[model samples]
Each structure stands twice: as C-alpha cells, then as structure tokens.
Target: MSRYQQQSAAAAHVGGAKASTDGRRLRVGVIGLGIGRMHIEGWRQHPQVEVVAIADPDAERLAAVGDAFAITARHASAEAMLGTEALDVVSICTPNKFHRPLTLAAFAAGCHVLCEKPMALSAAEGREMLAAARQAGKRLMINFSYRFSAQSRALKAQVDAGVFGEFYFGRTVWHRRRGLPGFGGWFGTKALAGGGPLIDLGVHRLDLALWLMGYPKPTWVLGSTFDPIARELAAKSGKCFDVEDLAAALIRFDNGATLALEASWAANIGEAELMETRLLGTRAGLLQHNLDEGYRFDAHIFMEQNGAQFDLHLHPEAGEAPSAMHDFAEAILQERPHPASGEEGLVVMEILDAIYASARSGEPVRIAA
Candidate 1:
C-alpha cells in the first residue's frame, strides 16, 4: 500500500491509555492523537466527561499525551483501545479518508461518534457511515465547527425569523495567501485528503451556507480547480505536492437559490486569510466577514416602498457559546439532536463530489438522486 494509505490503515490500531475515574463521568476514547489532542482538551472541560483513553501509532506522541493527561495503559492502536475501554463515545480525528471506517468501528463497538469533517472522502462513504449509525442506534455528528460559532448561529436566527425574506443568492469564501499545509504530508496527498482547499477549508463554509439556507438540496454544480500555486512552489522548494491549491464552484439549489463558493490555500490575494459568507434576500441581506476576527457578522435590510430608500445596518449580539466538541458531548448525554448530523454532512459531500466531477469534465454536474 502507499505510504498515505499505510498511515491511515495503521491509525486504526492506535489504542488509548486508561484513567481511573468515577462512574459519573462519561467514558471517552480518542483516536488520532494529532488533532485529537484538541478533542481531549475540550472533553476535559466538561465535568461529565472522562477521557479514559487515547490512541495513536506514534509511540512518542502517544506517550506524551498519556503523560500529559496523567494516564497509564497506553495502547498502540485504536482498535485495541476500543476493544478494551468500554467508552460511551469515541471521537474520530483521523484523516478524511479514515472517517467512515473509524466511525463504523466506533458504532459497532457501541459508542456514539463525533467525527471531524468533511465527514468522509465521498458521499457514498458518508451514506454508509450514516447507515451504520442508524443501525447501531448511536449518534453520529460531524465536526462542522463553524455551526457553533456565535456569528453563524445569529445569522441562522435572522434567516429563520424572515429577517432575510425569500433569500435568493449567496456567496461563501475561504481564501488564504500561500498557506499550504505540511508540505508533503497526508494533507497534500489527494489519496489521503480527497481534495485540497475545497474539502479542508471550503467544507466549513459549504456546510455553513447550507445550514443557513436550511440544508437546501443542491441540484447542480459547476466548478474549476487549479494547482498552480502548490505545483510551482513545490518545484522551487523540492517538495512533493499533488493537490489543487484553489477551487471555485457555482451551485444551483432545488429551491432556485444560487450559491457561489470559493476556497484556496494559496492565492496572490493580499488577505492573509479571508473567510466570509454573504446572503441576499428580497427583504434584506446578511454578511459575515473576517472570520479570523471571531466571525463578526453585519446584517443589512432595505426598505423602498414609497420611492424613498432606507438601508438598516444591524450589529447583532454575541455570546461565549460552548465549543462544537462540547456541544456534541452534551447531545450524547442529553439525548438531543446534534446540529451537524451525518445526513447533513452527506449533503456537503455530495456537493463536493459534484464540484470535483464538474472540474474534471469542464462542465456543470447535476446532483445525483
């Protein structure tokens, strides 16, 4: 198997260390110690959760996490950890390709899953994972972290309240200037990451857009992808780069609303990082700009009934909401529905697939039924 595939396969076996805890804490096991560390930290904030185990193939990293968490019983494999620890939920933080398999394994092991997005490498894999979750009667949630952002929630409230009447057109963008990740790591490998900026950064905005639009079904998509930045930079730096550095798509929804999407890891744009979403409606328009600045959003409403034009600017209130991971834990414990479900993630995957297909064929691709 290829190195990326081997790494992904090996990840399945990374096990967790044991922690002595009261039965009141919800036992949890985390796979993929890299970003999984974030999950561990988030879970620690909740008194109801006990991160009983963590798994990763890298012995040094595993040992570091175990030591930091003050836990023993470190295993070298996720399967081993799942086999040994009777966890209530397992957080899967592996690469995009491993999401489905790990989630299925967790469900089969009788644990709910909080997986990082873009859920799976493809829509088909997402469907399979959803089915597995349904059959196992376990909660399956994608880590579409943006959904938990206060700005995003506020925008949703406005949209749902008819503040943005009959929303029609929207634009979402996640752009970076020369921000390639990990040089030749799995992130740059198409086989491992599925795609480049679209799946990684773009997926967040896509899900955000869909969620704001009430998870509208995309009917068709036209997209273009380019790897000019990565390929040229790799040639000069003597690095292995084989993924698109930029991707853009136009999506048409079943409700007749249209969305323009753009994502890039490397662009000549002056912005160090720019992430924003804008929605237009008959009654009003809403925009969230400069995501790095805590995703502050501004809402605009127009009134022109008597030939006198008036524009209203709204600065909505914000709050210190719970982290997405924390919310997932609450859903598991409270038996409430998670905001980012497996099915919602599937829609994002379907749009991604369509974008890829459209890019390859140089034509618009219709969403598959």
Candidate 2:
C-alpha cells in the first residue's frame, strides 16, 4: 500500500467509534493549575469524565483552582496525585521541561496522557514518552489547540474531501511585536522552554498547516534563530532571557512539497500580533488567518474554473469547538483512537529538533527516516 493509504488506514483505526463495554465514567487528574484550569473545564463538559484530583507545586494556586473547580483531592505534586488517585486519565499542563517526566509517570500508573504542546524538550524525550505510552497500552495526545478550532476543523474537512489536491507549497507564521509570555519566568529560560516562539507559538501553526497537508515527511530544514531584541529587553529590565525571540525556517518534505515557517515573540512589525497559514495545492490554494488580532479566524479558497478566477470564503458557523480534552474523553469512553496521537506529536518534535539543529549549525539539517 502507498503511504497515503497507510495513513488512511491508521486514521480509520482511530476514527471508528465503539460503545463502552460498561457505562463507567473515566476518572481524571490534572497536573499544574495554570492551563490545567482550562483542561478541567474541558473535561467537565463530557458526562463520562470526572476530574477526581489535581496537582500543583503552588499550594495557593492549586487550592484556588481546585476550589474553583470543586475538585477536593488536590496534591502538592504530580507524584503525590498519581500515587493517591485511581485516575484513568491525566493531563500535563506544566512547562516543556516537565512534560516527558510527568507523562511517563502517568503512563506508568496506567493512565492515558493529554500532554501540552511542544511534546517534550526534544524528539529523543518525546520518543521515550511515546514508547512508554505504548508499553503501558495507553493513549497519548498533545494539546494542539489551534487544530480544534471550528475554522480549522472546517478547513480540514475540505482538505480531506479533495478541495485542495496535492499541496506543494505552504507558509505558516505567528508573530508578536512585544508580547512575550511570563517574561521573567521559565518561558524566557532555554533550559525550560527548549526554545522561544518557534517551540511555543510556532508549533501550533506548523501543526495546523502540516495536518492540513496530511503531514508529509520532512526531509531537511534550513533555519535561523535570533534573540537580539529579547536579550536587550532582558538587560534593560534586569530579567533572565536566554532563548531566541525570532526564528524562521525553510523545510523540504519527502513528497516534493516545501513549507516556510516563521515565529517571533518580538519583532518590529506593523501588526501587534499576526498569525496565518496558507497552503498552495495543485487544485486550489487555501488560507486561514486570525482576524481582529485575536483568536477569531476565517478561511478562504482561491481557484480557477473554466478560465475564470474564483474566490470562495468559508463561513464557519459560530460555536465552541470541542476541546482536545473532550475529544480524548470521547475516544477513551467509546474505545476510539485519540486525536493528535503520540506519533503525530513525535513527528512535530522531530521537525522542531531539526529546526533548532539547523539554526545552531548554520546549515541544513537532514532528518533521518
């Protein structure tokens, strides 16, 4: 079978739904109270999910979130929660440095993991986490939240339906003029974040674009990273900053397609914030971009029929798209495949690893198949 055929079969394996053998709600435990609050809210949406416990190093923040969510079983650390609760699912919402260790701990406890983005500090760690999940026979999913948007879902449907056939070129980017998160925190620390905007903000856009393009294998990447602005800002503010503020890459895929990716936490640009992804295919070209410098987004398709130029804009209905946690809950309860599986997350990690390597070496980095 061809690669696309294999991908289709794998997707089918995960997409087919089955009824639960017994009607029992899945018990969940969340790690970290920052983004973990959102995870709790999403999991609560599903009737079959019960958030039983929570873990956070910050006792005050943990108590506040746990009380706000009405979850009584709160622990000071993930190890404590994993040791105490009989949770069937665990969500890791901590820093990039903690994802692999926390995910491994959850899997060792025989729980499925819903890990936050950038999978791990590197592809090597991501592979270890994936192997552990497989050994434990549990689902491992990454929170690529951008892909869960209504506009993105609609575009994915169209792409799968052959609306844009054989994507050959693409561009995905996210930039901010001066919007670094937690400027003095771990986000600015290379040891914690692995990298700057590329791993943090760019991962979402890159995943959205690559998923739309069917995630073709990347062959090589030529990339560059810069931190002049962030370093200067850190010096002036007397804050610690060691990661790049801007990064760009040219990636070549195995299917003869090419993608250009750019990300920045600080840049001298007209827009305060900008995010976009465009895929040029043989049949049609597609564009998805944020509107009003906010989370809201819209899509458009460019095509020609009978020698006439045609432009069609998508009108995605307004509704809250199912959260990644909600989808994970349904997948577990219905015995279906997890969305944004570990394998896909590993693929993203591999590309990211290459981008960083290329940036450091000042040459193209080749990915090993």
Candidate 3:
C-alpha cells in the first residue's frame, strides 16, 4: 500500500472502535492551573463528567482555580492529587518536562490522559508515554488546541471530500511582532519548555498542516532557530532568555510532499500576529489565516471549475467546536477515536525533535524509521 494508504489504515485502527466508559460520571483531575483551566472548562461543560481534583505547584493558583471551578480537591502536586483522588481521566497541563511523568502517573492510576502539547520534551519521552497508555489500555490524547478550531475542522472536511486532492506543498507560519510570552518564565527556558515558539507555537501550525494533509510520514527535516530580538529584550528587561525567539523548518514527507513552517514570538513584522497555512494540492489550494492579527480567522479554497478560476471561502456557522477535553471524555466513553491520539502526538514530537536537532547541528536531520 501507499504511504497515505498506510496512514489511512492507522487512522482507521484508532478511529474504528474502542473500549467503554461504563455509563458512570467520568471523574477528572487537572494539573497546571494555567491552561488546565481550559481543561476544567471543557469537562465542566460536559454532562457526564466531573472536575473533582486540581493540582498545581503554586498553592495560590491551585486555590484560585479550584475555587473558580468549584473543585474542592486541590493539591500542591500532581502525585498528591493522583494518590488521593479517584479520577477516570487526567489532564496533564504542566510544563514540557513534567508531561512524561505526569502522564505515566495518570496511566498507572488507570486514568486516561489528555496531555497538553509538545506532548513531551522529546520523542523518546513521548514514546514512553504512548507505551504506558497502550499497556494500560487507556486512551491518550494531546491537547492540540489549534486543530480544535471550527475553521480547522471545516478545512479537514474539505480535504476529506477530496477538494485538496494530493496535497503536495504547504507553508504554515505564526509570527508575532512583539508578543514574547512569559518573558523569561518557563516558556523562555529551554530546559523547561523544550524550545521557544517552535515547540510552543510552531508545533500547533505544523500539526494542523500535517493533520490537514492526512499526516504524511516525514522523511527528513531542515530547520533553523534564532534568538535575535528575544535576547536583547531579555537583557533590557533583566530576564534571562535561553530559547529561540524565531524558528523555521522545511519538512519533507514520505509521499514526496513538502511543507515550510515558520514561527516566532517576536519579529519585525507588519502584523502584530500572523498565523496562516497555505496548502498547494493537485486539485485545489487552500489558505487559512488569522484576521487582523486576532484569534479569529478566514479560510479560502482555490480551484478551477468549468474553465473559471475561483475561490471558495468557508464560514463554519456560529457554534461551539469540538474540544480536546470533550473528545478525551468521549474516547474514554468509546464514542469515537481519541481525536488526537498518542500515536499522532508521538509523530509530531518526532518531527519537533528532528527540527530542533537540525537547528543545533546546522544540517538536515533524517527521521529514523
């Protein structure tokens, strides 16, 4: 079978069937009160779910979020929460370094996990987490929020409908003029966050492009990362920044398709923030980009019909889109495949690993089969 065919089969294996939720109110625990708040929000909105426990190293944060969510079981550490709370699912929303351990802990406690992205610091850690999930027979999902957008799903619908027949080349980018987040907090620390915007922001756009392209196997990657403006800003602000402020990569897939990816937390750009992905395919091309540097976006499909070139813009009706939290619960309930499964998460991690490695070595990194 072809590479895309193999990918389809793999997706089918994950999406086709699953175990069960057993009809009980699925109890949930969330770690990292930062983005973990989103996890709590999604679960609380779900009918058959309960946000029972919350964990964070910061006591104040734990208490504030716990009180905000009406969750009484608050602990200063994930281990404490896991040991005491009876949870059916856990959202590992901690720093990149903590993902592997927290996920393993959740799996050990017989809890399915919905982990925040970049999956783990490295593909090796991702492999371990994926293995633990499989051994425990529990669902594992990565919280790739960019793909959860309604526009993303709408594009996926068109791709599935063969509008983008044989997706070949693409460009995915997210650039910010002066929006370096967290200053020199965990986000700017390489040891804690893995890499800068590449792992933090680029991963989202890269994953979105790959997911839209049916996740073609990446054969090799060439990448470059920069710390130009961030280092200067850090010096001026008295905050030590060690990670890259900008990163870009050229990724080639096994199917001979290629994608160029760029991400930056700071740049001398026209837009304050620019997020976009343009795909060139056999049948049609696509452009999905944020409007006015805001979170909202508009997508257009380009193709020729009856000898006339035209564009088809998509506008998903005003409504809530499916979320990582909702899908995690449903995956546990055997309703659908884990929308962003551990396998897919690992592939994304591998791609990220290759990109960073390439940047450091100043050479293209070939992905191990």
User: Global CA lDDT of candidate 2, please?
Assistant: 0.87
Tens-digit lDDT string for candidate 1 (201-242): 999888887887788889999999999878877888786677
The lDDT per prediction is 0.80, 0.87, 0.84
Give the per-residue lDDT of model 3 (tens digit) for 134-185.
7787778888877777788888889999987999899999998987876768
Q: Write one digit per residue (lDDT tens) for candidate 2, span 128-161.
A: 9978876777778998888888888888988989
True-vs-predicted CA distance for residue 54, candidate 1, Å: 0.8
State TM-scores per candidate: 0.87, 0.94, 0.93
lDDT (0-100) at residue 57 of candidate 2?
93
Better of 1 and 2 by TM-score: 2
Compared with the true structure, model 3 gives a TM-score of: 0.93
Provide C-alpha RMSD values for all models, in order: 6.7, 6.0, 5.9
Q: On a 0 to 100 scale, what is the lDDT of residue 38 in model 3?
A: 76
Best-to-worst TM-score order: 2, 3, 1
